[model samples]
Target: MRAELPLAAVLLTVVACQSPTAEATAGPSGVVTWAASADRMGDGIAGRSYRLVVHTSVGGTDLRIRLSNAFGDRPITFDSVYAGIQQEGAELRPGSNRRLAFGGERTVTVPAGSTVWSDPLPGRLPAATDLVVSLHSPDAGGPASGHWMALQQSYATQGDHTAEESGAAWTVPTGSWFYLDAVSVHVPAGTGAVAALGDSITDGWQSTTDLNRRWPDYLARRLQRADTAVKGVANEGIAGNKVLADNPAQSALNRLERDVLSQPGVGTVFLFQGVNDIKAHTGVTAEDLIDGYREIVERVHTAGKCVVGATVGPFKGWHEWDPAAEAVRQEVNAFIRTSGAFDAVTDFDRILRSPYDPARMLPALDGGDHIHPNDKGMQAMADAVDLTALDCDTIG
Candidate 1:
């Protein structure tokens, strides 16, 4: 649903001027049940049709999708767009596939650094179903707006096959999602969502692909089953992302509004970041990272949302970990636990660290990478979340 933002949020709406941040990220009247943080991919292609398969968290009618050209140097046009249920690889469930329109037009162009949402398609979607969004961009090029590490494999073809239910023509398989960023469903009144903002761990790096096993995915399932007001989940993580600096992708601080607060029905933000900044040996002190956390809490509060802070997990054997970084992690975790800066805290460090060696990750949960968590670790992180903390209005 279209949410009204305070005048100060004007600066945060980096999308097109005509489209407000709230409407672009959240549907006009529904909560964003699924979203992927958008970043610049290699480049867009003309006549490229993508059949992206994404799992839903909450069920509702009138589903909508948001397409972006946020990083393009020039305007891009999408000639045809369709949404359907995925039957299998590059194949759609017959008769479930339907067309999507933007402002009553079949064709729409999104300017550089902007996004657009499709008119809600009429139908009911069940929770946990695989929803496929297929679209063909007639004239697409320049730095494409997409997520680089989807971890889930989707399909692509050379021509406009968006309207077809067959998978015969969709030959290319891709690991990243292009253009399509956010999806929403018209949920019951007062249904809120939680957006997880972090780095690779939250981005589902070590999690199983296409299985929806990211920590956020597990949290989504939890929210769906619980009697809480929050049922939607948005994963706003990026690999190699930092909290205070913009390099691999925009820093968590920089993209907070567009990726988190702008999503409709989002009442809480889960902040689990900082390892990259510490382990990178950037001379960032514990105080520095704490300030970043404080700023995030303050901003989220200002936006009328609660913040849930997570302690940085141990990474003793990672290539970049060092004594100094470990010290910083401990100090930061101390502040997160005792400072009360956040409305709530999730002790991921306490949950994932080895009892024998606090600096190292527990062997069973280490996904072969000392820095990233395994599937079990991801589930543990999600299970550790206090679901009640996700709905600020209800909790308050």
Candidate 2:
């Protein structure tokens, strides 16, 4: 079960698991949305482009791409769009590029507040490589969404909101690139999947925009190195998601089955939530947080799945971090390290916290928000994982 670390003024580190295996598998088919920005509150202007580059292993036979404007109120317009293989550090020019068609036409109008999957294209993918996709926008402001990875490096066209005359090219420096939506890679059968279920910390917020340095990415890299039978980690961390009923965006208890259990062939879960409830102003105490975690663990076990609990890290400087909340944080951390409700415990708090400053975060890991970790901080969190819990050969 799950356990927690003791309340002591000491630093602790543990080498719990080995490198994981990584192998590319067939991705889903039939209109998978590339990416969607549900909230369009941010700025969409010139020089602010959203790019996605997907890392895929060779051997896929068919591929396709799409664009999303799920949060936009009006139809999104694009001047140009292009897709091509990633070469060296950028997308290869038209000789290796393909034009995506919308309704048998090069340009298409995506209805407001919805997603449109791409029409399939005939293409052969190599094993273990990156696909760089890029997009551009002529108009200064438009609602947008972006996928974490794309195969094409540039998309350019005649004017804003116009895709009909767009052409696939080596490079277009004028228009603003929007975002890469999604891609479909054909894979052989019998491929397993990994899903990292957590909060915004796992959403790759502060990490370099497209470096693919998130912990789940790191875990995928590890698995690739080990030749594990698993495919890749589909990240399921919503920025504001939580463990209890406090978060309105669907709590962990409410979405567990859908986000974690309902996923296809999931072998492991890395639980990295609950700090929200502990630091929330609702007065939820430490014991209450533990009970909430316990309930989640019980449900995961009932599903015949292995669960790993990551101790809630400190948030002393957070807006809600008060003495009362700090006390609860300590209590919850202790329970996570010692309770044994989970099959294994990951000491994320210990690894990310400052040994010199017990009350605050380590300066290096702090994203300046004190509540979340930066790129280096995220790397540290990924480095803290103990992969042995997923070892069916050794796990009890």
Candidate 3:
């Protein structure tokens, strides 16, 4: 008699064969899922055209792709979607490319507020390459909602319903899919993983949907150029996460373990937290915040991983801004600058602050809120990181 695989077991075996373990991170031990989303209210209009840019470091022999509409109010219909390698910093022009899909077919219907991954495709990515993903719509669309994770390249297609051509090398148009998620790739062993843990800035709001402009994506490009061993980055930043409790959504401490420690093969941790903690109403004292930092540091260290701390930047217009908070900000900066707890430090304050008005934010970097950094500021944030800090030998 021959042994048999149960239905769920058969599904698991198929996923394993597609994604594989050596080229994958440790997790539920199966196919890696990818997705993205959009909304109608204030994000984009229904029936409007939109595009998505996703960066993947999964350089493997076999791969699969998925798009999401999990946030839409109605079923998202797709007309045409294009995938290819990015040429010159998200410029969706000509490059080595091909039309990708779920098992060699086109046109998919993703239910409202849901996700869809493509059947496995033979995608072989070189080290540190940026994959450009663009989508087109022929009708009024919904408010775009998707997280900025991956450490590679991403871009969005523009125009309302009749806008058609998304300015790609191709001229065809596709319907629309609200939720665009994961693009999993099969890989080999010894690949390094990136963990970008922070707040809304890292989460990517108002930064042009599908542009993939999150700072970590730039870091991914840098890492790819410098070391192929570094695979990809996992973005764990929540829109309102704070270092301490400001509110549940705005608290980084509340989600650190779930967001950072829980990620698979998190070889390095890059922290850009604490702004919300200080900006929260009735914020804690500098010493109190320091104690919180100490606790977080201990937990991260206990996980046998290295952490890079980011100093808080100037935020005079925040609700909690006051002499006491400013003083605390300086205190925290001093601690981050000198503390041996962190393996390295990235001074975002130094990168985006206005020298002309040191107390104010740099107009170019500030996203009109005088708090969150704009796309340019996000780029500066990525540039501030010393790529070598993620080197295994350096941390280990």
Candidate 4:
């Protein structure tokens, strides 16, 4: 935690920082190589410098990052920013650290409820690499925006140490990714990307931290090795997020444009949400969830993209599991499989469920929570995705 500073001290006005007029200037042509769904993080800290570590999917030249202040009530200025390759812990690979500028300036202020992308850095980033982004906010507070459950350890410190490649200055370890939301690279002209819009399962819950074992991570590795044009995978998943309602994390439907459609080179959207809404018992029936899926598919198609719907994985052993919810899940899964509303379908329930007990997760795949999957289960889910189905040719 940051030193306890008065709210007034951190809430410096935009004029005080001498920030430029904030706008989301369009970035260079590229594909999103990595992404994490953003939500309302706790209040920002004054003089907090964050060294956020993000894993790359499909790497290419001219790397860029998107910083978000989507939930802030006032403008926030990022005075200094740097990108580098992680060598160990908080240390960067020497000579790989490079300064990043926003619209040709070393600093950029992002207004409330907006996101800004930095100009592309000249370099070729390989696949499955750990890319590090270090930044400092001189004066920041109010509602901060970030990805909540990173499942990857990051570093932080006070003051502007954005240019440091040594881990000596960064002594604090944190799990959440602050400000940075997405990373992109210019790939082959025809190459495209896919966004996995899901909940905790897709958010990598129960998987080992710092080791990218999330299902989407596995899928990314597969895309790199296989002969698929859709090589980029963006995990736009938030824990406890739902398809119908918003709370701590915005609902999938509400955040669709920002998290998925708006991302660069997105050709496919994999929908894997609904367990939260179904188990919460918020008077949401199979029909209600089905309607939500229809809307997502329709909207994605309207954006000239393809949509892949996954059946809700079985969770009979979870604390919230009940016969009523199971019935709704079954009905929803049935619709997802046979209705043909989606551009394609992945039967996650069929893949993760125990053969002996239709409604229970396989013991080997269970992450102890019954709802989330272990590392092996995450691999299984990724293996079940047909790489060919991600092609955007299916789009109407």
Model 2, 1-396: lDDT tens per residue? 333221111121212322111001222342111221122333455533333345542234445554655555666654445455554534443354455444444444555654554444555554344654545554535655442222123343333322122233333432222444344444455444455667767766656654666666666666556655554455666666677873545677776764565444555666888877777668788877788888887887787767788887777787878888888888888888998787888888898888986768898988887878887888788777765665433456
- Clashing residue pairs in candidate 4 are none
Model 1 Cα lDDT, one tens digit per residue, 1-396: 665322112121122233334445445678887889999888788888898988878877678888988889999988898888888898877777778877666778888888888877766777777889999998998899999889888999998999898999999999999998888888789887899999999998899998989999999999888999888898989999999999889999999987888787788899999999999897899999999999999999999899989999999999998898999999999999999898888999999999999999999999998989999999999999989888887554
Query: Per-residue alpha-carbon lDDT of model 3 for 15-85, expressed as tens digits?
Result: 22232222222332212212222222235444434454455643553445555454456665565655555
lDDT of all predictions, in order shown?
A: 0.86, 0.56, 0.58, 0.89
Q: Where does candidate 3 have its weakest 10-residue lDDT segment?
A: 5-14
TM-score ranking, best first: 4, 1, 2, 3
Q: Give the local distance difference test score of model 1.
A: 0.86
Number of clashing residue pairs in every model?
5, 50, 49, 0
Sorted by lDDT (best first), the order is 4, 1, 3, 2
Of candidate 2, the 10-residue stretch with the lowest lDDT total is 18-27
- Distance from true location, Cα of 337 in model 4, Å: 0.3
Residues 257-338, candidate 4: write the lDDT tens digits: 9999889999999999999999998899999999999999889988889999999999998999999999999999999999
lDDT of candidate 4 at residue 119, scale 0 to 100: 73
TM-score of each: 0.93, 0.63, 0.62, 0.94
Tell me the deviation in Å of residue 237 in model 1: 0.9
